[model samples]
Target chain A: MITCDMAVSIDGYVAGPNQRADAPFGDGVGDSLHQWMFEAAEENAAEIAAITDAGAFVMGRNMFGPGRGEWDLDWTGWWGPEPPYHAPVFVLTHHERSPVQMEGGTTFHFVTGGIEEAVTRARAAAGERDVSIAGGAATVNQALAAGLVDELRLHVAPVLLGQGERLFDGVGRTELTPAGVRQTALVTHLRYTLSRTAG
Target chain B: MITCDMAVSIDGYVAGPNQRADAPFGDGVGDSLHQWMFEAAEENAAEIAAITDAGAFVMGRNMFGPGRGEWDLDWTGWWGPEPPYHAPVFVLTHHERSPVQMEGGTTFHFVTGGIEEAVTRARAAAGERDVSIAGGAATVNQALAAGLVDELRLHVAPVLLGQGERLFDGVGRTELTPAGVRQTALVTHLRYTLSRTAG
Candidate 1:
């Protein structure tokens, strides 16, 4: 099963505006969205573990790094030499670059083909385990519009970032069924199953 | 105290598009947002009661009816003779109309002076009881932008209305702290307190 986990503000922003190399998730966003994951780590351990438990991960180029356009070969992502994924990670981008092997088992493979191609490659690498779509609004929106996602896990923080990258903006009219819900003081974890599947 | 209760879809849309006299909440949103309130009345009894517990209510013109421009003197709102709100109700509109008195002490008072004026009138009528901002997005956004709300009670339904009237749109950058949370099978009740107050 394909699943995605996202941290969003109450106003539907995944990340605030003015995202630069200094502020990865954007200017005002900071780590506010993921405060529950860190501040209440013990309580949210299962959800935290689930985020990186997938065999392979697919992510957007912007999520991989803040650099746009041409490949910045020097920048090896925000994560250190040993990234958290510890699995094959497919990054969606327009420009192609050689796979960057990291410590542990994580390997960053750039996919120039598109979201479909990246997911396809990630699925192949995933084998028996699930292929997780690691996002930055754009990639998730694309996957959602394509009906590639089976489950959507949203961690809605209680703050509002008036303007930023919004979710479901151009995904068209979609329907979801509630699968699960859990809440903490800082965030509400809402899980949804897509009513329509990729045919 | 001022409080607002809104039924929002998972995607943040308060109501869907093509809102007509027949479809008050627009197409594809026919009572889905309030399904939990009806289907699980016993479970959500407290929330249901809290919604109409306010002494006075303020709402936007669109939420009152589908008519535009001049007031339809014949129309008396969606509810019949005796509405659920058995108190003074303030309707925000550009076109002015005389107060319409109904059964059960419910009165529809039109306010052409804008959201502040409507809310001010509702607050006055409320006396000691909390004044409720009965919404249809635009008015809610206006109130939120103005920081007139003291508390916000959001009933997030587990469905996605791809397109429609959305909440928190153009409200500028705002912040909310989580105050309460409750979840049932069909909906999640999230209550938040605004960090910024109306001065």
Candidate 2:
């Protein structure tokens, strides 16, 4: 299964302004959007577990870190020495870099080609397991536009960020049927199955 | 109580392009987005009843008809002699005209003052009963931005209209807590209470 999961604000923004190492989700925003994962960890254990259950993960360079242009040699990632993904992760980038082996069975392999190449590599690494597309809006949009995603899980937070990077900005029209819906005080989890018949 | 009700596509559009006298929802769009009201009328009787139960309704001039600039004195809305609104209906417009009394106690009162004035008149007409803001996206957004609406009921249709007027285009960051949620195959009805404390 090719699944893509993302946490979006009610206004459909994934991240706010001035993304950096300290403020990954932007300045004043903090982690309030993702309080469901932290504050209600025990209650949302299944959701948290589901997010990291993929055999292989594909993500954009922006999601990996704030580094742009040439790769920052020192910057491993935001998750310190040990990353959460216990499987091979493919990072789509313009500049090529050697695979960075981190603690916990995670390895970040840089893909210079494109989203297709990253997905191809991730699918190969995944083998029998599912290949997950971890996102930063643009990456998810690309994957969705390419029709590479089979399952879409959206963790919709109640908060509204008036302006930011919208998940479906240039994604155009795509058909999805609701497979499941679970709601909590913090966020609403909506699972959708991509209809193969739809363009 | 003040309430705003609108049926929006998955892409957040309330209506499609070339909204005219013949095609209110636009050409080729048909009534597919509101199939629940027609095909499943018996199944959604309560929802249909709730929509027309408003004592007074406030709608934009665009929603009233396709006529622009000067009023076509002959045109008295698309609903023949008797409209669905059994009570007084206030139409917001820059060009004022005498109130047109229709059959079945329905009257189209043109309010030139503004959205606030329209709501005020609707509230007055409603007495103790609820006033509904029947919309065309822009009107709803204006009401939401002005913080005049107390409750927002969204009928989210599964259909995707890629380009059209979005309900939340320039409404800014208004907060809403989910009051209730009901789902059917045709639409997902989301009721929300407008948070007075939120901006």
Candidate 3:
């Protein structure tokens, strides 16, 4: 299944303002958005495991690093040398770069073609396993607009960012059926099955 | 206690495009948003009853009618001589008009001052009973921004409008705890208790 998982604020913002080199989430706002992942690790163990369990992952350039234009060779990613995805990870970007092989079988393949190309490559790499769309909002919106996603899981945080990058800013209209719903004090896990035939 | 209730699309839009003289919800979009009220009345009886059971109600001018600038003296409201609001209903408007008394003890008191004034008048008329903030999106956002609403009940429709009047457009940051949640095939009823102390 082509699944996309994201943690969003009540207002549908995936990340807060001023996304830069030092402050990725801006004003330490992103930290509060993912408190459910760490603070209630035991309770959300299944969800945490579901996020990185895919055989291959596709993410936008912004998710890889804070740099723009030229590729910053020094900055690998937010995750250390080993990273989390123990499989092939495709990074969608305008600028092309050679694949970076990290420790623990994770290789970052920069795809300049577009979202479709990245997903195609991820699917090829994934084989029988699912191609997970690890997002930063824009990439997910692109995927949804293209009707590439099969399942969409949203970790809805109770907090509101007020202003930032919204998940469904330019997504237009997409049909989804509520497959399942689970709630915690910090976040509500809503699972949606995307209608391939409907828009 | 003060309460705010609204039926919104999955994308948070309360109303759709091209709101005109004939189509109040903009091109028959409002019908799908409130299918639970009509189609499944028996199941949602409590929710339907809760909406108009208030002693007094407050609404924006937009909810009263589609007229802008000056009030069409003849235009009482979309509702006939006898409106759903059986009690005193305060309408927030810039163009002040004399209170229009309707059948079944319903009176439309046009409050020119602001949301606070409308609430105040509604509160006075309500006596010990709760005051309801009947919405058209803007009014509810204003009430939420001003920290006037004590409880928020959202009738979340499964459909997606894509673009329209959003409920949390410019309400800034507000804290709310999920008080109650109920779901039907048509809609999901989410009740939130506004934390006036937190923002």
Candidate 4:
């Protein structure tokens, strides 16, 4: 299955504007968006575990690093030497680069084609398990528009970021069937499966 | 206390686009946005009771009728002879009109001043009970932007309305402290208290 787990504000922003090397998620958002994953880890244990349980991961170039246009060989990723994904990770970028092997069996492969190419490569690497779309808004929106995602998991925060990257803005009309819902003081975790039937 | 109970789609739309006299919530939305209130009445008994528990209600002119500019004296409301609001309802409008008393002790009073004036009148009519901001997205957004709301109860359905009357788009930055959360198969109920801190 192709799945995506994303965190969004009450105003529908995934990350606030003016993202930089210092502030990855952008200016106002910062760490508050994912604070539930850290501060309320115990309450969100199941969701946290499910986040990285996929076999292969696919992410956009912006999610991979802060640089643009050319490749930044020095910059590995937001995560440290040993990345969270212990499997292969396909990054969608315009520039192509050689695969970089990390400490804990994690390999970063650059795909120059597009979202579809990246997902295809990730699915091949996934083998038996599912492929996760590790997003930065643009990539997830593209995947949803192309009908690549089967399941969607949303962690909705209570704050409203006025100006930022929004989710589900340009993906067109889509139908979702509720799979499950869990809530805590910090965030509300909602899971849904994309409906294939057209009305 | 000034409170609001709003039903929104997963994409943050309170109601779909192209609202009319026949299709109240717009084209595709129809009664789907409020299907939970009727279908899951048993599971959401507490929330259902809390919704109409308010003594007085405030709403936008659009929620009152489909006509614009001049007063539609012939039309009363979408509801039948006896409206749901048993007390007084202050409707914000640009035109002036006399109060229309309905069955079951409900009275629709037109307020030409604005949202603040309407809210003030509703509060006065409420007496000891809480005032509710009965909405159609525009009014709720106005109340939230003006910081007139004390609590917000959101019933989020698992559907995506691509275009419509969106909530919190131009409300600027706001902070909400999560008070409670409840979930059913049809909808997820989230309650939040507006935070007063500047930071």
lDDT, candidate 4, residue B132? Answer: 97
Instruction: Output the better candidate (1/3) by DockQ.
Output: 1
lDDT of 1 by residue, B19-138 (tens): 999889888888889999889999998988999999999999998988889988999999998999999999998898999999998999999999888888898899999999989899
| Top candidate (DockQ) | 4
Scored by CA lDDT, what does every candidate get? Answer: 0.89, 0.82, 0.85, 0.88
Best by lDDT: 1
Tens-digit per-residue lDDT, A46-96, candidate 1: 888999999999999999998788987998888999999999999999987
Candidate 1 stretches with Cα past 4 Å from truth are none
DockQ ranking of the models: 4, 1, 3, 2
User: DockQ scores for all the models shown?
Assistant: 0.65, 0.43, 0.48, 0.71
At residue A143, candidate 2 shows an lDDT of 87
Tens-digit lDDT track of model 3 for A1-199:
8999999876777887889878877653756678899899888889989999998999999989997798987778899999999999999988878999999989999999999899999999999999999998889888888888889888877766677888876777655666776777777777778876422
Query: lDDT tens digits, residues A92-195, model 2?
Result: 99998999999999999999999988999998999999999999888988888788888888887766666667787666666666577666777777677786
Model 2 misplaced regions, further than 4 Å = A197-199, B27-32, B197-199
Clashes of each: 0, 0, 0, 0
Report the Cα RMSD per candidate.
Answer: 1.9, 2.5, 2.4, 2.2
Sort by lDDT, best first: 1, 4, 3, 2
Better of 2 and 4 by DockQ: 4
TM-score of each candidate? Answer: 0.94, 0.91, 0.92, 0.95
> Clashing residue pairs, candidate 1?
none
lDDT tens per residue, model 2, B40-130: 7877777778887899999999999887799998888888899999999999998979999999999999999999899888988999999
